[model samples]
Target: MRTVRFSAVAAVTAAALTAVTACTAKSDAEDGTAIQVTAADSTCETSTTTVPAGHVTLKIENKGSKATEVEIVFPDDRIVAEKENIGPGTKYRLTAEVKAGEYEIACRPGMKGHGVRQKLTVTGGTTVKRDPKLDKAVADYRAYVQEQADETLPRVETFAKAIKDGDLEAAKKAYAISRLGWERTEPVAESFGDIDPKVDVRADGLEPGQKWTGWHRLEKALWADKKIGAEEKTLADRLVTDLKDWQKRVGTAEITPTSMANGAKELLDEVATGKVTGEEDRYAHTDLVDFKGNVEGAQKAYELLKPVAAKNDPALAQELDRQFAALDKLLDTYRSDKTSYDFVSYDKVGKDDRKELSDAVNALAEPLSKLAAAVVK
Candidate 1:
């Protein structure tokens, strides 16, 4: 299952944008320095709609029954910054950089649909200096994300072609291949606030009245039902079109070093919550393919930030490197063809084998979680 993803922006011009969770939120809110937001099932209230552009802090409390998400988004629904999966009765502090412009404070109840919203106006504010090395990390990470998006389109086309041609076996072969690029850079793809739910939302993740489309929907048709029909053919074409949108929009996505680090951590969370549990590729049993993609994506981000992170906190960086290697080596043990993504079927793995994989993922995830703070410090 896919949870909501947090999105952050890199510094552009004299004003660099980024997001972090602030621990001193109570004091900040008490001092009236942070914007107070109250979220409920159908209502989203903010202390003020206007703020000086620069570093904006939101003190959010979810009073709703379900887990909610809050985002500062552009009018076109591009996420400026967001914090997802805020549980009921929980308070969270979300801090992000903003430029003077029009945006909205969106509260998504149950982490689905466009929930309640309030207008947010950012006024002129002073610019702050940023570390140049962090900027380079952002640039490189952006390019890598774009490269993955560029590569993913053609593979998706191949999968779509197989589905359209009614070649069940061929479609099965193409399914995992097409998803490699997506799984790698899912955070970037998900930043758009709309694409992920359309292209990647699992059956269980769907809300009421939501039409099931994209990979998993088609996966059910191919592997579970064992046949392709008219709806399946139409869905294949839709998948290609949706992914093309992702490819075109990749260049415009917001990127920051912290976001890259956070995204890397999210990938591991995805593995622990979905891939390792055998729930992601439930019908196809190709969870290992996705597991590799998530790890590769996380590692790519970690490598890009290693220089800065090492300088700030050498011990954390070293531990991260060691854990990542351990996890990779453990994963390699399951690969039938070491040169390819040909891992043994997840169903074939024994209970103890699954536990080993789970342990490896958790070991790396613990240290990787600290990467963002190390880089910024």
Candidate 2:
């Protein structure tokens, strides 16, 4: 789960109107026209505000002084697609399948705040034809997300129960187990906009006036404070309640073939930015557990989309398979048990070990980023 921050609605609306002229354009999946997005420190500018419903591509350049994030979002701020941590002066191509609707192209400089915005209108157009297998892949991915959510709740209950009972050791043991499903399916949960912050926000990620809740908050109390107080117990129950909301909402999350592919890459990004850095499970040092979960989730998506990706670009598919296997084997080396999540603690890992892991993730991420385009072909 990642921290979520939003800009004031009025400010976003005014900026969006000023950034782009409201104009209609005729374009479709076949047109292959790309929207040019330029992101700077205080502004987000889009070449056009309208496109026909189908596959949409953004050619993004970050002219910002700091790293930025770009997203295509609903008016209510649910993300359709996003590419995070675009370093200064870097370029990225983000592709997403969007239906006819009103949307916004948001650019968050420094990867914080609501960001600069431009209004986007997706006009009704002929649906892009897809292979029947792609549809099945989406169906299966939805089921996989649901199953993860369903499994997560009971484990979370056990964790919360341990907390309520004041059983610190039991709570600590259950913590990583409870988070496995969440780590696996975070991208789907993040599509909902509100759930992640409530259940996953870290103390540093919280905006002023935002109450600190979620797993990380409890994590600090358990491992850092080394005690579970009354406040921690109350937060434990809140965690279960928030996750229940996530479980109920999973079925309704927007899922597409490209989203699955993109989400797989996002999971790797999570590993690079959070898990590998030892920031995600800082207190407990269970970074490897989350790291493994993220990799498994990415693999599941790639495997589901492999048939189409392989057909479109056989070489890319072959490279992805090799890299994934290599990374998995490398991760296994750190696990003494080999059959469970019993990997070395992040703090115990040496600089060389961490570098090896980081290298493996980068090797896979480069090819995985191309999967979206292959599947959409």
Candidate 3:
């Protein structure tokens, strides 16, 4: 029984608090010695307990006095479970097994404020109940890839138009313009593990004469050292390849709508789990810093999720459409207001950041998540 001081984000009593929906339900366990982690500031309380490696039950109840959540992390660096704002006077549950190792437990009000933390000690356990939902996750991810293949062509055309029309600088900027978007999509790509070689495009890291798969390829072109060249042939080649593939349906030879939606879902999952990286080269952002990474992440979410619209169920489709509308507004506003993003300059973001626009981009993740759940189901 060691008590350690865990630094959690504190909530500002005077600050305005927005209503937050639960990100996921609480996990279950066998010990039943479930402890409730409560927020000293707000009357928010969450059910908690020790996680013994293997199968266990964790009942994270939102005492409903205020919005709250609990995050269960594992030694494997897996965010095994997360229970967010269960609602006042209401509760949500998730049943999951734990694995042996060091773990970090974080229970907070939302992404903004102070919460609670405890170390979960687990030796091991023998329970092998895997959720079938994960299988659907795989299928859902593939569908996302298809969606990207389906939609990126148009954007590629827009990009090509900018390039062919003598906007070489625009062309360079556009190369990795979608790198963040692609990075967001990569996690889902990883889960597929073995993509259909004939259908799924390979981004097998940069190699000689190898074509680029997603947005990062373009980013490479933009940042490459030119050897006395009038134009970046590599960057132009990728655009051409991408645009052509879009037209001819490369990698998407047999993609179903569900698979595409799943892929989009997987990308969003990466963002929530922080599995997504910000940028490859720190200096890469010299041209466009923080804004590009976030903006691209947001844009990729939108671009990759759109096609699945036609394939989603009625309810899911409607939600996706709604999210798209809001996100579109955010992107439009962001583009028009360059002052909002510090991409072109080293200016720090002010209190009135363009996060509204950025959040709009990130927000699509929710609907997309719903869409992914439905697609996988």
Give the C-alpha miss distance for residue 233 in model 1, angstroms. 1.8
Over 4 Å off, model 2: 10-31
How much does each candidate deviate from the true structure in C-alpha RMSD?
6.9, 2.0, 14.1
**How would you encode candidate 3's per-residue C-alpha lDDT over 92-168 as one tens digit per residue?**
43333345666655555532233444566655554344344433433554565566555555655565555556565
Candidate 1 structure quality by residue, lDDT tens digits, 193-302: 77887889888887666688899999999899999999999999999999999999999997776668767887897898789999999999999999999999999999
Between candidates 1 and 3, the one scoring higher on TM-score is 1
lDDT of 1 at 168: 99
Candidate 2 lDDT for residue 294: 97
Report the candidate with higher lDDT, 1 versus 3.
1
Backbone clash count, each prediction separately = 1, 1, 34
Candidate 3, residue 5: how far the Cα is off, in Å: 40
Each prediction's Cα lDDT score? 0.80, 0.89, 0.42
Q: How close is every model to the real structure, measured as TM-score? A: 0.82, 0.95, 0.35
Model 3 bad stretches (over 4 Å): 1-170, 173-252, 267-322, 337-363, 373-377
TM-score of 2: 0.95
**Whole-model lDDT, candidate 3?**
0.42
For 1-377, candidate 2 gives per-residue lDDT tens digits of 56576645523455443454335544433425478889888888887888877788888999879999999999888899999999999999888988988999988877766878888988776656789999999999999999999999999999999999999999999999899999998899998878998898877788667899989999999999999999999999999999999999999999999899999999999999999889899999999999999999999999999999999999999999999999999999888866899888889998888999999999999999999999988
* Candidate 3 local lDDT, residue 142: 50
TM-score: model 1 vs. ground truth? 0.82
